[model samples]
Target: MTEPMTADQARAVVYDAYTTGLPQAAAAKLLTGRATPAWVAHEYAALRRRGVSSMAGQQTLFDTEAAE
Candidate 1:
């Protein structure tokens, strides 16, 4: 059986999935053999709560810079 993924691994999956607009289920399937979409979704929420910016959020970067 595959070992469970670590928090860091989970974070990477969440980041990639979130930034690329992929579903949490896709992230789980791509990253961890044993991870679930629900778990990845939870990680994604946790990342947002921690103030990690997603690509969607970064869309404003160019606008903000142009305003300067």
Candidate 2:
């Protein structure tokens, strides 16, 4: 059997899927092997709660102005 994915791995998958406009359920089924849409949604919520930024490292106008 395939090994379980770590939290970071799952987060990366979810993030990539989201950025690419792929459906969460489809991403779970195709990439995670065992994860469900609910789980992916939960992970995504947690990532947001933790303030994880986008892969592109984009900053908001507020952030840019604050830095200056």
Candidate 3:
């Protein structure tokens, strides 16, 4: 069975896609098969859990439900 890709993996996928000239939306779709919401959240959460600076001031909310 294939291992699930983590947010870092997703980020790498995004980076590769962007460098390859893929549009942000299309690249995210093709690589992540999901929206940017959980990706950013998981990243930040993981970092904070590890006592690291995860996005911090750079955080952006892609999860509408989270704002509700």
The candidate maximizing lDDT is: 1
lDDT of 3 by residue, 1-68 (tens): 77777767776655454444444456556655444744544543454567643332233334455678
Per-prediction TM-score, please? 0.52, 0.51, 0.42
Better of 2 and 3 by lDDT: 2
Best first by lDDT, ranked: 1, 2, 3
RMSD of 3: 13.0
- Per-residue error at 20 for model 2, in Å? 0.6
Report the C-alpha displacement of residue 55, candidate 3, in angstroms. Answer: 25
* Candidate 1 Cα misplacement greater than 4 A, ranges: 1-5, 51-53, 56-68
RMSD of each: 4.9, 5.8, 13.0
Descending-TM-score candidate ranking: 1, 2, 3
Which pairs clash (backbone N, Cα, C closer than 3 Å) in model 3?
A: none
Model 3 Cα shift for residue 9 (angstroms): 0.8
Which candidate leads in TM-score?
Answer: 1
lDDT (tens digit, per residue) of candidate 1 on 2-67: 677787877776786777666667777786555767788788788779876666634654567668
